[model samples]
Target: MQGAPGKRIAWLPTLVAKRQDTLRAGHLRFAREAPWSGVLHCFVLDCSGSMLGGQRLALAKGLLIALFDRAGASRAEAALVCFGGAGADLRFGPAVPRWWNERWLRPVGGGGGTPLASGVRQAAQVLELSARRKPAQQRWLWILTDGRSSDQPVRPRHADEVVFVDFERAAIRLGRCRTLADAWGAALFAPDELIA
Candidate 1:
């Protein structure tokens, strides 16, 4: 009773009774075993021309590097996907960044049409592959974009949780990030919130 809720034990008599009468099924185990062990932090960054102005891309890159630091501190696996123009690239990894640095993120260039859908689709594939290898790992998708793209909202299939970071700045916003977040029922955050 003094441990985590996940560590609680129950007789589960009904579950045992559901089994056929046999010596092998006679044991009554009580300890609860949660399936998840840790989380995989997946970052999907939009590097479109729209983000080039106002240093949005630079902000996103900075935020991503910081997030990798946080993930490393938490002992979580980290991955990166950058999208622009026509497609998405799995730029970094679906692995932990043992030696992470600004150099690793410096090469992510931006300036083209926003392929937000492609980014989400590619991240979904990465998450799916990781899910197969680590069945108990929770996957968290972090999307950083200016939300200026015309691409339709695409919800990732394998992500256990999704967060959309909107970078759009203008008198009248497109709100594409909010739309995508709503489509996936994900949490939304502004670029300014990166500090907190």
Candidate 2:
């Protein structure tokens, strides 16, 4: 119980040692890392031409960063997939949200056609790989779009959960987002639900 002048065996509890008026560092020990059982949120953003003028893309990007923060706080993983005229691009990952903020999102621009199917498919591929590695991990696919794509919806294989966040706001709503959600048996949400 005596290594130095003030060193004493206080109490071996809660993995910490408390002396009279100070908490010394010697008794603060660390155990093994805890196992993580969390859902991986794969955000599929529609960076098409329709999302240009209204700042819909900007809103989506901001929401994505918030979601990233939420994922990090929850100790969950996150990914970002952007799709447009050409095809879907995996901007972020099936990786941890290490640098998911405004800085990382600023460079991601919107244009081209809305390849909704492509984005979902690309995110599904990432989910498949993640599934093989962390088989017990749950996967969520979040599609942020205005439902303007003419491409047929194809449900991704590895997504355990799905949500279609409709960004549409027009007189004659095409309701393609509802169609996709129906196809996947997923929940439907508006963009504002994120902030809430």
Candidate 3:
């Protein structure tokens, strides 16, 4: 899926299809299990300008859809939050089981600046609210970003678990993400490692 830098973006339909297939299979494996009573997985995606290149946003959307399918099969609830251009928005819902889907996720065009702090803060709030409603539910926060933002949150105190998936290419240096992950005691995974 490599492309010349600065060229107009091209949509890769095949890749999207393949991603959906893989995720569907993964979800099928979990479908046999008894439904978890109370659990929510929140996927926070970075929709900043930096994600426009390398089809990062496309891949992320695919991953989110896949995750939703898998979580649903496991009988877990899910939600979505997207942040970019100085603000964060809760695009999807705190829907349980069948409520999550690709249709809920809007295609976010990349431009302006990255508001990383806004995204993180909003995600934490979502988790906090969920915890209040369903204290027994296990909450997981999965953050996908290139880690190119200049702003950062003080620290998140709400999530039961946080995982940072850095999509930045190998040539680029990961600034603040490692530190942020360390501070939050969150698991950190890179794109290369995840796809491998």
**Which candidate's lDDT is highest?**
1
Tens-place lDDT digits, model 3, residues 1-196: 2323322321222232233245432222111121344667788888988888888888777777777887777567787889888799887767764866666666566676789889888888888888888876767788889888877676566676677877776475766677788887776776544452
Among residues 3 or more apart in sequence or in different chains, the pairs in candidate 2 whose N, CA or C atoms overlap within 3 Å are 85-113
The clash count for each model shown is 0, 1, 0
**Which residue segments of model 1 deviate by more than 4 Å?**
1-36
Rank all candidate structures by their TM-score, best first, as comma-separated numbers: 1, 2, 3
lDDT of 2 by residue, 1-196 (tens): 2233333322222121232235556654332133475568898999999988678889888888888887776667898899988899898877788666799888888888888778888998989988998887878788889999888867888887787778898788899998878777777778785475
| Model 2 stretches astray by more than 4 angstroms | 1-35
lDDT of 2: 0.77
Q: Which ten residues in a row have the lowest lDDT in candidate 1?
A: 10-19
> TM-score, each model?
0.81, 0.80, 0.75
